[model samples]
Target: MAGRGEKTVRAVRRPEVRLPQLAAYDGGELEAEGDYDGLEFADADWAGQSARGARFMDCAVRRCALDETVLGRARFIDSVLSGVRGVGTDLSQASLRDVEVSDARLGGTQLHGAVLERVVVRGGKIDFPNLRQAKLRDVAFEGCVLVEADFAGAVLERVTFDDCTLTRVDFSEARMTDVDLRGAAALDIARGIDRLSGAVISPAQLLDLAPVFAAQIGVRVE
Candidate 1:
């Protein structure tokens, strides 16, 4: 386990998604247990739709609106979601593997109990993301802004936050392994300051979080 101030030396494995020719999807409403493969969903409005247990593979969803959409237990493999905007989008228990989510603007997104592996989220702003009890492995967040993200009880392994800003993130009961927070632009933890045994942060971050650490251990610094 690396110390709080020490940086994790392990390099995170990033995803390399190579897409093929995609067919345009002409579906009107989302169907439950729908199977979408190699499809391109451009500028589709999926507001207030339910796609429970759907499977999406080798697909691209660009500029889509997902407001109040339910995607519970959905599986997304080798897919890309770019410029997607949403509010109150429910993705509970969803599985994302080798996926790229870029330039997204989401609010109140529910991802509790989700499984994400080899996923990259780049250049996005996410607010109030609920990732409680989720398992994340080999995931990277680059140049993103997360506001009030709840990561309580999540398991993170080999996760990297590169140039990402995390504001008021809750990591209570979350277990981490080789989770690198060294490259984060700004990190503010709302809870669980003592659960950083396996995770690593830069010296500047350590200094920035010193007050929280001191409060956790009942130490007062003048």
Candidate 2:
């Protein structure tokens, strides 16, 4: 729909995580800087454990409990994490590439300064996720519910939110490129309405956000 050489935005590249036949992780506790590859972690209760700088490649983490677990600077590549429930899980500065996280139940999860590429998060509820200063590329969030999510000072490229519900989300000073919000089922911005320069939204969504937009520019809509 360009009359005079307007730019056409490209969509995000979804993650294709094909996990290999994995061995079961029957270890006692996750050690720091541990290298885990081609393993499966199911129904694990690793609350209050520290696994800083751990690497998981071609693994499956299913239905695990990560309450208050510290996984700072962890790296996950070509992995799938499904039905994982947790609270206060710390994954600060972690890296995830070609990963899929589905049906997760998390609260107060800290993902600040994380790096994500070709990651898909589907059918999950995350509350109060701290994603400040994160770098996300080609990330898609589908059929998810996010409450009080923070993206302050983050960089997002080719990120799409499809059929997602966002409540009280903050995007303060965030930078975006080719970010699509057209398929969001609900959108509620608690802060930083002025930081949506590179995002695309539907006409109906724009109308719904008119009041917030007006307030951002001090427009008296009387």
Candidate 3:
């Protein structure tokens, strides 16, 4: 079943952009120079553009739409990204440290080989997102909905998914350590228990697992 899903995902290709190129600017509408850092880009429409090897430090990117944007080897440190729609964006080899992303939509986003540390994602919908070969440490996801998200071959440490809804989310072949799933809704957990090998849960979650144990032990309950 997983193999079939992968094949289906590979079959569907995203649409290409056809709009005129938008001029790239740096801080205070200045021309972007080499190794751009400490830039603030708010309410900018940077769609269908690739930002590679750029360093965005202490930036506030609000109400921006980076649809179909390719961001490779870029660093976003101490950034605030709110109300952003990064659909079909390729964020490969990107590093996002101490960033907060809220009210965002990241549909069909590719996060391969990305490093996310001390990041918080809240109130967002991340559909069909890929995190393969990514390293996530001290990342918190709160009040977000993830549909068909993939985390294959990823390394996750101390990641928390609080009040998130995960449907058809894949964590296959992911290395997870010190993962806390406390206060998470059981119905949000997609796939089988065997797939979640290294996940830690609270006692309330044990109540949800009681029925599986009861069935295995042949216990009769009212």
lDDT of each: 0.93, 0.93, 0.70
Query: What TM-score against the true fold does each predicted structure earn?
Result: 0.96, 0.96, 0.75
Residue pairs in collision within model 2: none
In lDDT terms, how accurate is model 3? Answer: 0.70
* Model 2 lDDT per residue over 1-222, tens place: 112344655878888888887899986899999999999999999899999999999999999999999999999999999999999999999999999999999999999999999999999899999999999999999999999999999999999899999999999999988888888999999898888888877789989999999999999999
Runs of candidate 2 exceeding 4 Å displacement: 1-8
Q: In candidate 1, how many Å is residue 10 off? A: 2.1
lDDT digits (tens) for residues 1-222 of candidate 3: 122223211111111212232233453422222355455566777787767767777666778888987777788777777888978987888999888889998789888899998888889788888888899888888899888777888887777778987776667678876666664554344434444555666656768766754664678789
For every candidate, C-alpha RMSD to the true structure in Å: 1.6, 1.8, 11.2
Error of 1 at 89 (Å): 0.4
Q: Which whole-number lDDT from 0 to 100 does residue 56 have in model 3?
A: 72
TM-score of 1: 0.96
Candidates 1 and 3 compared by TM-score, better number: 1
